[model samples]
Target: MEKDKKIKLGISIGDLNGIGSEIIIKTFEDNRMLEFCTPVIFASIKTMSFFKKHFKSAINFHGINHTDQIIHGKVNVLNVWKENVSINFGDEDVKIGSYSVKSLEAATKALKEDAIDVLVTAPIHKHNIQSDSFKFPGHTNYLAEKLGGKSLMFMVTPTLKVGLLTDHVPVKDVPNYITSELIHEKIDTVYNSLIKDFRINKPRIAVLGINPHAGDNGVIGEEDDKVLRPTLEQIKSKGKMVYGPYSADSFFGSANYKNFDAIIASYHDQGLIPFKTIAFGHGVNYTAGLNKVRTSPDHGTAFEIAGKGEADYGSFKEAVFMALQIFKNREEYEEYSKNPLKKAPKKS
Candidate 1:
């Protein structure tokens, strides 16, 4: 945790059949990536060799039996699997799914052991990987559970940031999950994450209404006025700058998003639809309120474009850069808190 030490980043090679391997290979093509952190990929040497030939990437690989053997310039890969098997590119196989889960397990173990500073996960297909052994909804839930289940999903870009009140839930079931307690917990987590992780002091937060027109003043629905409004009042009493119950329809439009540091939405599509529209192929999905730093590209597994060299690496690059920036911010904030006299001027 020293300020001058390079962060030890552990990466999980998500769903080898998808574009995860391609993007991970493409991301390391930039030699400058080595300067930020020591990247260790939890995957098989055979699988990486297959990708190096298939994608025609210039990435060199180094086989290491342990994380202590990680080297820069060449991708330091831990041989998670002992057996060699044929890997059919772009084909869904349960064995590959099992292997993906194993890779993630190794990465999470390293994180828990304090062997790595941050985790950068690639995309994985939930449907293909949800067997009896690996039965989590996605990486967010799986990682949260491994880290004692105290985290929230927040999607971030340079222009906008959003935290989901309920993720991976059915639309009909979202309202039931949005209790007064849940709202308060999510708001508190987002506020603390902004200040501690992103170094934003006194962040202005906007909360989106569950119903249209903010329940049309209770004519359309009562959840916004009854559940959200009272919660905002409680948060305001604590001296936090939180506004809203704004109608979801006009909140993202009308350029209202620029006025706030973060937005809280009731469900998945309600927030992600607008965010993806604006920050498509550029957003990074961040898991805040966790003991460790974790981030992934906003996009999912691109099945159709897998292994064709057609998938874009923009979001993957953004996720890596965001992790580095947040790590730096956390370091500086810790230093400033300990020595207020050396505090730098706040950025405009």
Candidate 2:
């Protein structure tokens, strides 16, 4: 796995019309970022140049047509193609969608072929990016299918870690999807991710209730008691430190999250609202349970701020660092898991 060498971070250049190139350029402008890993952005050099005209940065890059040409300590861009379409920022054009898919497909192919060590994806406009080849809600679903594993949309920050039981679904449909089996699968993914990716020894997790006020003891809803609580009980009895069915509203207000390694939210907003509120500029959306490491900035494609030189690169930079760290941690964890110490002979 090239454990001794510096990591090669494969990046997908989200939507060409968005602020992806801006943030990516800003993140790698300082030479300090290169010391940890080599950044190979999967995009066209022309799109990068367009963004460079808007943002004033000293970020220089090396253009290559193939992944094998990647060089350490440089912003190596593997241009997917010499894009023929005219550049137009902030518009959701089909041309942009096709090119974005090319970037994603190429980057993912590199990841699967072991050409790149980790992947830090940029944001995409959901409506425009949909096509015959891509039919999932977002990156998490697409990655899960390609990478082969149960996907868990985990939002991570320094203080809090939140995983979703159900992701990228409608608010009304959330209840029907949250079954005991789904809870077990998501929580198990979180527990293992904490141990291997984040390097936590024992990951104690909390689950937020599905109903308001935790069903108010069934006065508000029935899922909290009938489904969630019983499932958690079984999980705890089976040797995992899992707990909850706690009221979601008050859970984050009191900062009770500090007491646990991670929290499992019933749906998207129930977890993301508080997380983005606290760590919007730096939060990382990590797709756990995938065979390979993948992470993204918490925010979406900033169409309004495109080419304005005002895009914040904090979250994107954090995503890169997070992916690198996870790659290292997983390597160490796998080696540790593979071999155990032998018992010494008893003294007479």
Candidate 3:
């Protein structure tokens, strides 16, 4: 494929009982998405038929037998499985969970083989999907393991981009996982991703403190002062524009976040709470530092409103848009990095 050409995207239909299929149908309603890339959904034709009948969507569905049959401006589904699963709205089924994982595995295989330029995943049910066969925590860890374990989950919005040092872990065990080496690795990953993947020339990053009031100079806790500060200093000395140990409570409200390109949060909630508050229906949960571009909707499987045709598709749309943008950005960066001073015209 040409570097500047429209990239092919592989879409994985998540939990069938949830709002995954519904949102995927709703998002393709916009014909303009076809102008950017060709989307190939790794799902069953029966599942798409079920959603079309249930939701009364007007999308034109095409059952693709081969990858060459993928067409833009249409929903192209590669039926990987012959699942005769009947879905109940808001109901949990192990069969649906297994199907979701199967679709993910297919999409991941395409990504690894370079068949797809990017991967846009729908929301999956973590609790329902948990099994002995799939012992990973969630999509982040699962993708990490599949992609050789070099991945970090970061929730991105226009206002605030928050990267979690540790994701999907208990709050009590968070402190135990906090180490200078871990912080260094996560921040390094985020910083390099900003420049390489996102195409930011000079990335400025802000790291949040672990404890309340930023440890109040070691009064409440010493982790911020003892661990994070020294790491920040070492990173700063290495010529990366990073500043941190900021109090999580006040940092969200302050305009200082806009000064930096990305925020490295201590844990999951500390980063997501403010990110969702500002960009609830617009946030894109991107798994950065991976070899390939991967993005998902920040929201989860809204099983309560699954088949009612009432689930909001805003986040899912943003996730798709983000994948397209990042794919293009990475391509541009790679081209420019290879040949500096090329002076390409700006894209509209």
- Candidate 2's C-alpha runs over 4 A off are 1-4, 342-348
TM-score (all chains, Cα) for each model: 0.96, 0.95, 0.95
True-vs-predicted CA distance for residue 269, candidate 3, Å: 0.4
lDDT (Cα, tens digit) per residue for candidate 1, span 1-348: 665577888889988889998999898878788877878889988888889999998888888888877765566889999787676667878888888898999999999898877899998878778788888989989988898646888999876999989999998897799999999889988998888777678899999998888899999989988898998999899899999888899888898999999999999999999999999899999999887889999998788889899999999889998887887777777788888899652632
- What are the lDDT scores of the predictions, listed in order? 0.87, 0.87, 0.85
Find the 10 residues in a row with the least total lDDT in model 2: 339-348
Off by over 4 Å in 3: 1-5, 344-348
lDDT of 3 at 213: 85
What would you estimate as the lDDT of candidate 2? 0.87
- What lDDT tens digits, residue by residue, belong to model 2 across residues 283-334? 9999999999999999998999887778899999999988988898887777
Please tell me which predicted candidate would have the highest TM-score against the true structure.
1
lDDT of 1 at 106: 97
Off by over 4 Å in 1: 1-4, 344-348
Q: After superposition, how far is residue 342 of candidate 1 from its true place, in Å?
A: 3.1
Q: Across residues 173-254, which tens digit of lDDT does each residue of candidate 3 receive?
A: 9989989889888998898877776667688999999999889999999898999899899999999999988999989897
Alpha-carbon RMSD, candidate 2:
4.0
Minimal lDDT window, size 10, model 1: 339-348
Clash totals for all candidate models: 0, 0, 0
